[model samples]
Target: MKFFSKRELIILTLLFVLSFVPVVGGAIRILEIAGGPSVAPDNPRISNDPFPALLHLLGAIPFCILGAFQFMPSLRRYAPKWHRLNGRIVAFSGIVAAISGLWMTNYYALSIEIQGDLLYVVRMVLGTAMVLFIVRGVAAIRGRKISQHHASMTRAYAIGQGAATQTLMGLIWIALLREEPTGLMRDIMMTSAWVINLTLAEWIIRKTNNLSVSGSVS
Candidate 1:
């Protein structure tokens, strides 16, 4: 632990917390599917379809949780081979998650009245963009463009994390506003979720590279 610089320690802590969100969500979904109570399937707009939700949960576990550890500098430093191995796992599973999200946006907009079309459109655009970013990351790694690979993958992962952020934001909206969001208010908040997450991801990506360039552990 003493060997880790402050920045590295902070990043490690962040990764651990970030990994918790989706993995726990995934576990809960799996339990829900196994006949544990879940409010998810009761959504009228989603057509009560459990298929996409199932796929999304399964994909999310590996993409969000396992993917987070790929950012650990210690792992990369001491286990380069393991890093490369799990990098492949992260990339592939992320694609599955991205595609399932897009499928839900395009064909599973069952919560149209509650979620609104704008949120659907937001998911469509962001979901497709996430897939492209994942593909770009893979290509960058294949070409041995390490920096671009990292940046692209960082963007992909952050975009995926929007699901977690949106849940938190939704809770805040309900608590502070003292009511559930609807219409334009809901649309604005949902759109902001992805936009904010991606923007922050870009900043962190650049910061990590800058630190790496300056001979600091990123």
Candidate 2:
């Protein structure tokens, strides 16, 4: 049997494509930190305390890329061991990403024009939610609540992908406004990205659950 249906293939393709820019950006940041002195003005926060940024990048890259494969039902069914192992990696990576994100948000001395009060609160709440969702997913799987585990992990992955959506949102903001986002507008754009991802995640979760119910009934 095919490892992925046409729909699954499409989803995976989109996920990878969305991940490309963010992954590359993370890699560049890592390289900048490793190469030499802090030259990037916008990156001084990370340059001063690179450990959390490094942890976040290391965790987020794997979680965003490898976690995409976990959505493939055929792969999960046919290669349970790989699925389980990858799931563990994804889960651990997700926790690290979320925690490090929170750490940076709290400690990083970004300008109010860049981060703002609203953005700070939003980041804290969403970061906390991502960690909780991943923990709940692990617990659900351990308890053999497969559907709950899937839903929770899907939500966590969606939150983890906020950076990709934020990139898209930033581009759109620049296009529409003819200038880079700043202050409250930047906060809105960033928050909207997370909201959009979570909304789509919920829709997918509900659709998948409905399909599963219909299949089981038939």
Who wins the lDDT comparison? 2
Kindly list the per-residue Cα lDDT of model 2 for residues 66-109, writing each as its tens digit. 99999988778788999999999999999999999999999989
Question: Against the true structure, candidate 2 has what lDDT?
Answer: 0.91
Worst 10 residues of 1 by lDDT: 39-48
What is the TM-score of candidate 2? Answer: 0.94
- Report residue 40 deviation for candidate 2 (angstroms): 7.5
The TM-scores, one per candidate, come to 0.85, 0.94
Error of 1 at 63 (Å): 1.2
Which pairs of residues collide in model 1?
45-110, 45-111, 46-110, 46-111
* CA lDDT of each prediction against the hidden true structure: 0.80, 0.91
Residue 171 of model 2 has an lDDT of 83
The Cα RMSD in angstroms, rounded to one decimal, for candidate 2 relative to the true structure is: 2.1
- Model 1 off-target regions past 4 Å? 1-22, 37-41, 44-47, 215-218
